[model samples]
Target: MVDFNSTSFHPATFQLTGFPGQEAAHHWISIPFCVVYITAIVGNCTVLCIIWAERRLHQPMYLFLCMLSVNDLGMSLSTLPTVLGIFCFDVTDVAFDACLAQMFFIHSFSFMESGILLAMSFDRFVAICNPLRYAAILTNPRIVRIGLAVVIKSTSMLLPFPFLIKWLPICKGNVLSHPYCLHSDMMRLACADTTVNNIYGLFATLVTYGLDSVFIILSYVKILRTVFNIASYEQRLMALNTCVSHICAVLLFYVPIIAVAVMHRFGKSAPRLVQILLSYACLFVPPVLNPIVYSVKTKEIRKGISRIFSRDFL
Candidate 1:
């Protein structure tokens, strides 16, 4: 005999909480993020420019690197401006549509970055495992096709997320603890049952990011086995060195993601500041480190970067 419309036990709707009495802490956090954002933009832009300026660097690996740079740029641009606006100008008000748009691009670029990483892994596997067939298998036309597939596939997968959010009957607890509207955090605001959304989100994460990581690990394992079977110690060393940058990049990206997930599950009682800081850390750290890892670890890229700056100065 309970009337659904007459029920008084509605979901608790909390207002958007701004930074609470921590002006100094907020400023400190904002400064470092601004610095990191500048560094990421400059470093990734430099890498992309270097690859574009040098015709010799126009291989499949470099092409994927360029795509990664583009993805990183998109990721940074999607979240940083709003974060800076909030921290610096105290502008925490964001329209629902704008928030959804930011979330869409952030997830889209994240998925695309995962796809590009898988493509890079495939490139390395071919180059090291089957050198003779590398050129034949990863020709210009083939690379173009692969790139298009990456864009199309990532876009299709993430396109559903934002639309689903838009359709949700959100009952006014729109304040996201993190700077951006993350899938899980936004889903928490829905007044309707979110079981389907959670299931789909988990599935998307597993299929795209989780599966990509597994394949990359397998690729490296095979590469390692090949290296061990080779007679020349120098060749093994060289092969191992080639994979160093990729290994570092993967660790940097995934470790933070895992940390965020773990913290969300187990650290629910932790301070809100800790949760927000940790979540934002995961978003920004990988992009900041990616360009540095690639530049330091890849010799040709370093040389290309040098040539780019030298030309600019001339």
Candidate 2:
């Protein structure tokens, strides 16, 4: 609401600590972080490549899977620089504007990922409940619109973050909880009254994560009802089998998210590293696990990956 961007602005820089107290073991700490980041990027990319190479995967579910991978890739790339900077170079000082921008992108991609997952749930619901209409309902043009809408929604929800943070007088304290930036982490350091910022953050969380989780559950409920109506138990099991990867992905994303939220609300006395680890997992786990879940659960993706690896060996 305020034109904080009007003036030539260069706010004071902030220090990013890899581990607040255990600064001596930063390099050792980086080992796990490096593994997670590399795995997320490579795993999501492999999923994308496999889907693209296999014509049989040219369906609504795979398209949504592609969207999830893209969002995961964006998020990993977004936070990689800051995390590596703190762990490797010990470069902790980040400009005010840069910090705000990084936080904005990180949160935006996170919300975008949630939206993509919701779309994937709808894809599963349609395929399971009304198989005959799946193609017509999630055609290429419609899928494109849905993707665009997700991007728009994510941007709209998080676009104000930087500016809101800009208006905050953070000159008093710039140190954050983690090496990377986050809305909650950044807001806690603000010198001004952050009631509005806190409200907006909570509101955004409910709109994105809360509503999406509800719809995902409902989609599965309807799917279950439809599957159970089938005469054959084998047919029902096969129908539900298609959703195993999606179910795993939803758990991977939400479990860490809920953990972080609970820690923030009730675990104020908890160790800082615990909070940081949970937050990192909230972002890292889904990307790393999504591809693995799909590969293990979906026969097509597994065979496609096998063929690609066999060719590479030759």
Candidate 3:
């Protein structure tokens, strides 16, 4: 065993432990992961293309959706290479710099997705709670600004993590918990001081996930109140119906993340495979399911998709 206490210890490469204790089943695992990745890419890309080509989808709601599809695409692509490499090629070694870059992209996109979801919630709130001013409030230029702001905010918040990771002395054998790199997982390998890393990670989590979730809930609360005040029951139902797809999107994105956190905190005795699967669920399920949920629940998107297929057939 290498001396972790050495002052000059720094690993050049990190070995990814993909589904530990399941080496024999890696090939079988790759098949499902491959399918999920492909589906996510195709689904999100289809959503993006339909939104772009359909004139009617130029509205604020769909514009936000276009942002979401883009975020999901980024998230999927960030994890795709290493994940496939581990399961398919049996390549588990990732260069230190490359691992840090992967961690940055994966974490950045995860936070970006939260910001996008928060923005989507705001869009729904305005459209339902204040329909008359929806267009005025969520103007095209303003929407672009919102998109840029979310990207900048999420990216900026995570920008420090890579540098922080580099500052630490990694000496715990450089074995990663998942096929992908994460700030927490990387920090754990540090044989030196990690208090700063720990504190900052918690702070980043709160500012992104915590604040965004609070605002999203607040937006929906106001939305629900506005819907309830509508004189006609049908109108109230219709208004609520508009949020069904977004609500599903939010659940898909947050539930797995929450489960992973809870599992890590409370279920330490949980099987490694189970924890890894939950982590996979956190990263993989949302991208793969978001487009399907939206396509089924949102009429305009469905119509847009149908129109494309119908045109191709004609």
In terms of TM-score, which candidate is strongest?
Answer: 3
Give lDDT for model 3: 0.91
C-alpha positional error of residue 184 in candidate 2 after TM-score superposition, expressed in Å: 1.4
- How accurate locally is residue 83 in candidate 3, as Cα lDDT from 0 to 100? 94
Better of 1 and 2 by lDDT: 2
Between candidates 1 and 2, which one is better according to TM-score?
A: 2
lDDT of each: 0.80, 0.86, 0.91
Question: What tens digits encode model 1's per-residue C-alpha lDDT throughout 1-314?
Answer: 21112233322232233356675676676787789889989989988988888899998889888988988998999987677876677666666667778878888888888888889889889989998998899999999898899889888888888878766777645566665667777778778888778888898899998999999999988998888999999989998898888788778778878887898789889888777667766778778999999999999998987777798899
Over the full model, what C-alpha lDDT does candidate 1 score relative to the true structure? 0.80
* Model 3 lDDT per residue over 44-65, tens place: 9999998898887899999999
The best candidate in terms of lDDT: 3
Model 2 pairs in collision: none
* CA lDDT, candidate 3, residue 285: 90
RMSD of 2: 3.2
lDDT of 1 at 174: 54
